[model samples]
Target: MKESILLVEDDSSIAIVITAALEAEGLHVDRCDSIAGRDCLLASKPYGLMLTDVMLTDGDGIETLPPVRAAFPRMQVIILSAQNTLDTAVRASDTGAFEYFPKPFDLEELVRTVRQALGALDGSDLPDAAEDLGQGLPLVGRSAAMQAVYRMITRVLRNDLTVLILGESGTGKELVAEAIHQLGNRRDGPFVAVNTAAIPHELIESELFGHEKGAFTGAVARQIGKFEQAARGTLFLDEIGDMPLEAQTRLLRALQSGRIRRVGGTEEIALNCRIIAATNRDLVPMIAAGTFREDLYYRLAVVPIELPPLRERADDVEALSRHFLARAAAEGLPRRQLSAAGAALLARQPWRGNVRELRNFIFRLALLARDDVVDDATIEPLLASDNAAQRAGEPEAGIGNAAPADFATALDAFLIQARPEPGTLYDSALAAFERPLFLHALAQTGGNQLRAAQLLGINRNTLRKRLVDLGIAPEDALGGR
Candidate 1:
């Protein structure tokens, strides 16, 4: 006889489709709608495999896993849910679910997963004990993304493993490192942070491993490095991608041998500190390009934790905004609360700078808004001003015959020196130079597009077209003025 499969799904349409699919595969399929109904079914017969949804009519599908596991330890369980958050994936993994399928899943993939589960019916892959990540930690956000990060952090706290945190700039890579140090067994030990990118390339080795007096022409006095300072503690290397390859070799050696030789020093110092490295850049690409060392990358990335960009975690925006606003108020900025519309406005923003950008914007709102409650209207002008300032600072390829090279030529040279393949250079340069110029001209003329056109030496119709193309409303220019 074919093995039996139990499917617990609330949606009748989904159940019909899944049942048909499973039955077509020559397996006996049972269907139910809730955890209670599942318990009833489980009590009656043995199921070779179980597929369940997270939200059921009577109770959560996740709550049914324990009892199902307890009664049928070797039975394979697959969790299907509409909730596609990082937290949900982590929770499913913790609960020993064979597979997790987000809503709108591919039927072929589901069938494949089911077949694999049926072929490998065993409990050996599940954890002996599920780790308990304590509630209300320093990291905010109950978003699925944040929950996954929390789970990974808690897993590494008990061990002295080197952790590599990857994320875009300003996404709190440093904060994650700090949390690891604070929560880990090394809580009492000193937590030292060093920005590898900020330090001078020539002096980085001396800075990390210390130097004896008269080691070099500039080394007049004996100085202890970051490693010695962070003895029996945690050393956080921030922006580690920017470290020179020579320094990476030294770092890799130190990590391998658990010892470091100071500059011009004969004896090797024994090192006993946990290392946590963070970077916004993708090191794999750098490794391929020969800019970063592969061995060093492996050594640092033993336990990798990637932070989600702020835009990806939209559910947490309001909470993070409020947190920043409250902090600004406590620091003597005018007390303020975000209006519902303002909160929604924050949630909708792209937030290219991530959490740091959001925090700074909140600080600006608290400082600028006169009323206790900040609204969407109050935020618009400030955003315009901030955007205008950023645009104004961008390199402008102004038309000038005084120099031998034209604007584009100069830009090409600059781009070559910065990096060879500066993608979308022409359009970015044009937009950057045009925005502030047009906005400022319009603001000076009281939002008069015609007058702004005259001042900018462009046609009025052309100015109008540019404004429309740039998504700049006339009201923003007026408000900014």
Candidate 2:
């Protein structure tokens, strides 16, 4: 049972750093960008701690505190601000703030405070810190890569930190942003998502900063941008890598000053919204190539999270396949189970499109398979199409000198030439191949089963069985005599 935290902050950079640190400590965090968002989160679920900022887009945090305390007496509240005045601290404390910290505060101290707060709540309630990423949304997999990400999300939720999610397209970058928002202090706030790449270059600024009535030819009425709509909540900037250089500068200014001037409006409105930016492109390379701003990259990547591609976490395929199939069935599609050969086939393929593609494939497979079980016959054709696409994209080195670019293609060719029929030779050969692979992996990790399991993306128990099936005794796996 992870302790839940609520974080209310407007700075993207700060939110990222703080969230990363707190999550690393194994606490569950939720974020709210404004007072309204905070209120909504409070109304939905009870949190162990409430960390809020002094100023917000809609209203001040001090004004929001009393209502929150009145509603939930057990909830601990803390105020974070750039204002370091003695008056502000004393007033906030008097108004029921557990503590007040100035900007650039030590994140370690914040974690300590959170632990103490949780400890004070109930002696028996402190959960085992080592439990793998506790249950939450569609984000599954207990792989070390995912565990690290989960930890980062936990810490940042305890404080207002900006988050930069770096991953390839279809790897669920937006899902990560939603998780941060849903699990953080502002779970009740609106999760407004904006794709910077999708917006026209000319209208990017107006779309972000809102537009006044009659501001442009098509402006029949005043229109609020994502920033305002996400006030007291989260603003997810998807495809942020494609934001123009000019827009980046304006964004930097807004992040720094916490102010936004609407298009054709002189009034500079203060903003308090948590910012989560996701991009498939590598900002570092872009910065080096002079396309992306280096400063903005640093600003957004305070708590950078890199999501691994599906191929990299192949161990998760069977689990994810079953999960997707269940979801499809729930949605009125036929329920399907993967045959042993089908699961093996899925494991061999390189899912270039990552989780999203895998999910779509599962749904399609479920719909197509006449029987309850989806076997290799149903999987091979689809896998071949993906393999063909990959080979077409890759440059051929030579005739026989270069290997097949796609693993599925190579596997298909090997199985056909070897002529291993389904139940006997084919199954035996695969099990033989998989066993040694698992044993060798364990050996490489020096018998650290947990690490080996994570590296292989399978549970430890599964790895243990592979060692036994391969007849590689535990001593051999441990590199013993």
Candidate 3:
């Protein structure tokens, strides 16, 4: 007996192709152009599976799925959409779809998914629609690399699995964590983020697991740690690779036992939060070097998602450049539109700093560009200046890369936006320059103050004093390493 399948797609061409492929596999594929036609067919006939596109003639295919699922509880669903953003992916997952295939997906893979859908057509629980996922969708790009990431994210949206995101700095790891939290089952609870590497080795435990009054020199009262504060929610541990060995032991214990005790308290408070960890460092090498824990790595990386660096996805640069330009305008920067040549030129750069560097470049372009529509003429001068600065010693897009004219423009903008107190302008300006400078030095030395001092060609005592004066902790800057 051939199994029946319902495919509700508005595009006649795509429908023909899918129907031909499925019919060849000895399956009966019923095609429809709208949700109303789908309902009429489903009411008259039973189907082993249903494959639908996101957009139809009458209404959104995904939005109307809940009612269809209610009436035909046993039929499985697979969604196909041209909308490739993370929001659309999450929305598809919210409807409890058996699988989701973004446009330009592999036809073989789609056929395989259809076969799998029919083989296991049990009544799976339909997840409640996600509420208020927010307007801010940070993760962008529709490259095949990004599609892989989106699929991994959807797999974890309905569970509390510990997710470990791996990528170079500025590859939007935090944004990935934010998406999982906002789209996952625990969306109603708070999302608490703690950068473990930013806390001093001596204080990491107290910061994450709380501390009773007088537990340490600076413990003035019973403070809630990130673990407890994130109760029934999610805890995002950024830069997990930089956590000290001593703190890593304590973290492993908590994960193993599902409980935590304050630094000086007796009662073991049960942990009740989903943990999402991210680090740019390659942990396999770190594990062999006896820095990151292998056992703890296993626990954290139950489902590791490696984000593609910008160099690999240069195709997405134009889209990302325009996205950043729009955001810059919304944030009160001059409204600028990227030209075709301008986007092409951007796509050719190595983008050593990944998306973070590209975003910074776009914002600067929005600020300094001469014309409303920026072409290569507008972008070339800026790139030339930045390249000259890079050759002169600074990393790509560093503070020291600014020319005298560029420096003046930045200072003028700062003056306008900061509105510094008349008497404190010099002090404030000096502080602003020194903060990134010191942080850059500390980062190059891997948090070793002695080395950072040497790197900056300054006395260790001077470096220490300046770090304190500027409130720049070695841990804070060293996280990027």
Candidate 4:
């Protein structure tokens, strides 16, 4: 007998494509577009699997999971949705969903998931929904990449296991750390973040473990370190790759014993914080090079979570850009909307700087463009200019053999493609560029204002003044490197 599957999706085009694919796989597929229809289908016949989208004509598909499982305990449920957010994904997981697929998903993957779900159709304890996950999520995106990250975060929410977040700079590694801490068992406790790269090598030990008064030349007063401050909470060791070897040894000892000795104190202190470490650098190579301790790497990476760069999740660009634009408007920047053409343009960029780069670019667009609707015209000019800047540093090889200089032509095509709605482009382009330029320099210099100033070829005082003028936090100016 063929196993029957129920698919509840509102979009007809998606329904047709999915139905055709499932039919081709030799499984019986029953299509419905609403919760009501799904109910009728369920009551009439047995189904091995139910693949449903969150949004339906009448009601949410996920809301039916509890009831469906109660009635048909053996039936497996899988949620498919365009609403790709952590909340939606978590909720789907909470509903004992066999799997969750964010749309514009691959049909082949969907078929594969369906086969797996059908194969596992049996009575099991359906998990209850997680209530009140949190108020704010620093990370946003519904891409498969982000969904993978969310699942890992949920698994560690109740446990105190150490988490190592690995990603390129500007990929929101700290945001993942924050989410883990905020959504974890230690939500009530203090959350302390220490940028090991920003600290001098000599002070690394003193920073992680407090020092006794008069313990060292700078220890005129007794100081409590990050481990103590984050007791029963979370200790986020940002840029863990930059920690000195000596500090790594002490850190490993503390992780093993769950205890730390103050810099010069004879007494030992028991640490009770969940440790979350993040680094943009690849630690495996560092360990192989003996720059980073192998044992410490294993200790910190009990559960490793790698964040996807923006280029890898191009489907999420439009949503993320809108989110940032909304945030900018809420923070008193002029309100704006991104035209479809503009969003498509953004989705096409390499975004080497990743989310941080896209965010800053959006802010610049919001501030500089005179139009309420930012379309290709407004975006193309800026992108072209940026591409030119990035290309300027490249070594010139040959004239005819070189890549064609089509930046302006591309911009012109983009302009012709869409007419942006007029708004206000009154903000100075120089001012728009100045803050990010200085901030990038600061990040490259590891938040040392003097060094960043030197790199930018500006006076230290001038850099400080610019930082203040731009309302950029010293910590944030580092791009959370």
Candidate 5:
């Protein structure tokens, strides 16, 4: 297995040089230009070593060092900075930095330091081996929708075919990618991922295929690309829809011929990597509109998998809520549980942002809730107020100057006239308002209909009647939404 290294430097030139040197030495490198990019990388896989600069556009690289070290205690880190000073070096060391190099240091020395760091560390030092990769850390709920995703992942892992995962943002697309990588035969190999939308358009071609010295204006040295680094492993391309037409042609060629040629280089390099591409956008539409290549679409869709949004899996809300709460507790936050009402509210809410959004909200609640138990009262306002604002002018469930008789009547009216072709509007609206309001209210009332009604300024009997009228069963309501 190739040792994996995360190169977190903002300078494109330096990143290219370091990546090439490391690859030349047979080490796998994942490059990140900012802290946010680093965070996204860390979420999907573990790295053997981390090389970070002191200053980054998004935040200080030092701030990233401590958490990374804590999470992967055995993983070594080296600080490379143009702003290197005694105080900076001391701070980096204090955060368990393996070594410090001043800016403009020798690439050979950097490579040697990396080798020593890797030799000094053991595999057991990485994060818990990413237990059950595709399934991810226990994310609750046995809803058929979630179960289907689990089953699909299981099937995908049994083969090496390309996969295209379709889902909205925050729907755990990368998690699905990770699961595929960890469960497959190449689990031991490095999993290198690239976000097509994140890199600048002009530089993206070189970023993926690499560039020889003088390939472009600032291409001062030879650079190895992601495809070569991910050899014998998985290469996850997130937001594949954002790849440019020119790059797409090259990528398709690589997929078809199993070879890649670096920019400004004459030699063609053979590729031995698996491809897993993901996108929230509809590729078929893009292809129809002449934005995405139809041939590439067919190639990526060999084993396509679509993820159901959270609102569609309302049955899993309670389970997911508890799972996130436990995760928070494990992270040393105040321990908290979802009250019956809170859980019900969670279940009913339209989670437009999906599971990831739910997790963030739970973390926030865990921090703010006064007691160990989070009730409907506490969760309701947060979901309803913010989500209600989002729903105000939307076609479904909007409260315009013309108010309907009651909440249900208004919903029915909105559902009737504003309904688009059956599935689209219902799915979109369910994701938009009704669900969020229900979840928010249930959370506020601690899962008690009477309390939730009182909180909503309605009679308890009315609340009960409305809950039934909305086809919300007691079990489903009490579960999380």
Candidate 6:
């Protein structure tokens, strides 16, 4: 005799597909379209496992699970739903569902999950109901790409595992952190967020660890650091990849010991909060460059949640546009509705800056749209003009049409990522500026050191030494290394 499973889904088409998939896997299946019907089927015979949807014709699938749990404590349950919201995911987790699959889930994956649930009921670890907290985070998306992120958020809600959110700039990494903090066990505690990049390198330690009065030239009074302020709460570290190496050492020590001491204080304080870190930069290259600490990366990545960039999840663009439109109207901006054409147009954009850029554009459109509706025709001109204005605001590349280098832009970028000891800023900035200039001269001279030297208006020996100092290969040629 084959093992039997119960599937409770309202849609006949979905029920048929699921039943067929399971039956193809060599399982006997009983299906129902209502909660009452599900109960009727369950009472008729013991099921090897149950697959349920949150909504049913007769009653709520998840709400009615308590009775099922009481009647069949050992049977595992998997939730499938079309609601496709974070709230649904959490609710399913609260019922200790083996897994939550939002609609349009991969059938093969679902079949695999069913096999696993039936095969290891006792050994499997379910997300405990102890983490039933947090109003569903205000993340708006039904994209399949976002389902993984939603699942990750629900898992960490039951524990204090440190989370690291990674994504491109404006991809809502901070929002993911907020969701974990807001939905996790420590929801009631304060959620203190600090951008590690915004603080000066000299004062970053003092900001995070707090400093004693008279501890340094500017220390006049003792103050509480973010860690102490966020006790019994969550301390979010944004732009964590940019933290100074020295500060990373201190932070690692604090995380390891679960305690901290003020810069000059004698008393050590115990940590009572959770840690969540996020960064947009790719830490792998930084690790290779010796700019980021490998040990610290491992510590912060206990529950890493990588958010998909807006471009990767373009299917959500329409929903996100409307979501932002609703907010803009609620904030007193003119109300506007998105048309299918407008949404299609928006989705076609590269969205290079990710969600943040899209959100900004939507707000501007809501305020500027002459019609209550936005379509390709209406948004197209605005886009061109908006892009034009942005270009106008940008610093010119050079005076020539031959495309000379943009040193001003380059310098600004360098300063942003510049890490240099005081009084050495000149040397640091100089080297960065000279390397490209030297490389260009070398390329211009066709591998001849003397000619390259003359082209650079410097002595041959001096140019040779500078090339070695800057580590520029003398063999470099155009269009090749």
How badly does each model clash, as a count of residue pairs? Answer: 1, 30, 0, 4, 27, 0
lDDT of each: 0.81, 0.75, 0.86, 0.82, 0.77, 0.84
Q: In model 2, where do residues sit more than 4 Å from their true spots?
A: 1-136, 386-481
* Cα lDDT over the full model 5: 0.77
Candidate 5, residues 1-481: lDDT per residue as tens digits? 3289999989999999999999999889999999999889888888878888889999888756666766777777888876533335434544656666767677887888899889984523222222223234433456656655654565555468999999888788897787678767678889998999999999998999999999989999999999998988999999998899999999999999999999999999999888999998766645744558999999999988898899998977888899889889999999998899999989998887899889988988898888898999998777777677766865432232233324434444455455556457656555446555665677555688777777567788877776776777666656654
* Candidate 3, 172-256: lDDT as tens digits: 9999998999878788899999988788888889989999999888888999999999998999999998899989999999999
The 10-residue segment with the lowest total lDDT in model 2:
123-132
**CA lDDT of 20 in candidate 2?**
84
Candidate 4 accuracy as lDDT: 0.82
Of candidate 6, the 10-residue stretch with the lowest lDDT total is 396-405
Candidate 1 residues 1-481, lDDT tens each? 2278999999999999999997898878999998888999889988878899998998877755766687678788888887654445545655667777777677887988899988884833645233333333436675667756865775676689999999988889988888788766687899999999899999999999999999999899999999999998999999898899999999999999999988989989999899999988767656755568998999999999999999999989998888888889889999899899989988998897899999899998899898899899988888889889977865433332223223434444444444434466567667765776677777788998888899788899999999999888988787656
Cα displacement (angstroms), candidate 1, residue 219, comes to: 9.2
lDDT by residue (tens digit), candidate 2, 119-235: 775322212121222244777654445544654565565445789999887888998888778766566889999999889999999899999999989988888888999998999
Better of 3 and 4 by TM-score: 3
Give the C-alpha miss distance for residue 91 in model 1, angstroms. 4.1
- For TM-score, the strongest prediction is 6
What order do candidates take by lDDT, descending?
3, 6, 4, 1, 5, 2
lDDT of 5 at 42: 81
The root-mean-square deviation over C-alpha atoms between each candidate and the true structure, in angstroms, is 10.7, 20.9, 12.8, 15.2, 21.7, 6.2
Ranked by TM-score, the better of candidates 2 and 4 is 4
**Cand. 4 TM to true fold:** 0.69
Sort all candidates by TM-score, best to worst: 6, 3, 4, 1, 2, 5
lDDT of 5 at 286: 56
Top lDDT prediction, candidate number: 3
Give candidate 1's error at residue 361 in angstroms. 0.7
Q: Where does model 6 exceed 4 Å of error?
A: 1-3, 121-136, 393-435, 438-481
